[model samples]
Target: PGAAVVADAGAREGASKCPFSKENMAMEGAPTADGLLAGERYIAMNRFQVRDGSEAQFEQRWAQRKSTLLQLDGFRWFGLLRRVPPTGEAPDFEYPDDYSYVSFTIWETKKNFNSWRKGPAFKEAHGGGNIFSFVGMIVNGFMTSKGPPKPAFWRSMLMEKTSDEKPILRSGPGGRPDADGQQTLDPEVFVSMNRFTVAEGREQEFEQRWAKRESKLDGLPGFRYFQLMRRDQTPDDDVNYISMAVWDDRAAFDNWRNGDA
Candidate 1:
């Protein structure tokens, strides 16, 4: 979710809330191979509603922190975007009209995220009585491990790709909004990260279980698509996984949640 647009004076909560760490340092031109594939980390997805008619102000506020955020310990990438009109290219299962604007950021780990969240930055971004803000967590789920023999592949896929690139669901049929207004949704598109701990030696069984659940999701009316993925190269934290899905609308997503789908 998005934080409310406020005067710059009101935006500053404290420095610790938006700490300057090694990862937050700004990089110029393009990122290096080592820099891009830092390590496996958690994902934090934020949706914000900038104050009405204050889109410019909201963008200005974000501009102030670009360089600093780049150098943070686990800093990956950040995208600030506005909603677009729905197109026929969108899948029938997708909700055309949803959120107006959203911002997505990636961090190397929860610890890295804590830097900005624990202090003023969090309050300024979402707190401080900011009704214009919404935030959600994206968890990493591990599916496999090849020990250390395949370090490059592991790092490239697990650590690098998942670090701060755009999420899989960003632009797809599942995310598009409808033009007719015939389909109503709850919150439009609401994304979150989840973790399910399986018993040791039950990894295969767990995958099988999810496969069944995901298969059933496909048959549901509002359910468009659901994706399950694990991080790339690093093994110590490869268990982390991410699930992204799209629905027909808010009501459709709610129906599934309520067990009415």
Candidate 2:
């Protein structure tokens, strides 16, 4: 849905434990791209950078595939976002950037998400009911030579928004992601995110800085939603944080960037 609300940030743990992961990915915060954190609600993204001309094929995989997340607990929202190529670009695109596609998901809690990961639904949604699908693996390697999915996760710190409506789910045929079960987002909406890595031991200081800063985005045109997300971290980890903002379109974002607050 285009509309979203500021969700409550309930009891939080300093260092979240691993729910069911085989190995931790040094995720002491920027939130493990693929990890379990201690929190009430979690946002995760699996970013993919396919070969130069393979974007359509990658999206097709998600569009045609079946996801059983709605049937699983802790699931709240899922969306496939495509990066808008830099403006003023011609046939040859050159931009030092991140993921070309992001598979976004929202969960009620970290534990619930880990549970689903270890459940049969994980296997089923990943194509077939196999732990390691050799066919899928081969295809992934051959298709995404650019890079594999980078998992980035975050816990909602502040959810300032333009609306208070929660995501609405309706009945659909076989509960397909593209069916009429979910609300459609405006085609022009855009999301912009920046990754920050704070020096170790200064995470709290960084957060305090953000909390105390005066933001001028409240009344901006085309602004839809904003979030400050943090990751699970250990003592030795460099704190990672993601600042995300949702706008009406790419032009809106550019306008904000070109103007002074």
User: Cα lDDT of all candidates, in order?
Assistant: 0.38, 0.56
- Tens-place lDDT per residue, model 1, 1-261, is 222232222222431112122222222222123223233445444333333445443443433322345445777655444443333244433322233444556666657776765655555553255412322100001101111001111111122122223234332212333312222222334443343333444544544555555244556655654444433323222343455455555566567677843
Say which candidate scores most in lDDT: 2
Candidate 2 global lDDT: 0.56
Model 2 residue 174 CA deviation in Å: 9.3
Compose the digit string of candidate 2's lDDT tens values, residues 1-261.
Answer: 111101112113332112122432344434233332234468766555545555544444455555678788888767667666555667366546544566777788877777877788776765475544422442344234433344566686666676544334432224344433133333435788877877656667766777777777767777777777776544222337778887777888888888885
- Reference-based TM-score of each model: 0.34, 0.68
Highest-scoring model, TM-score: 2
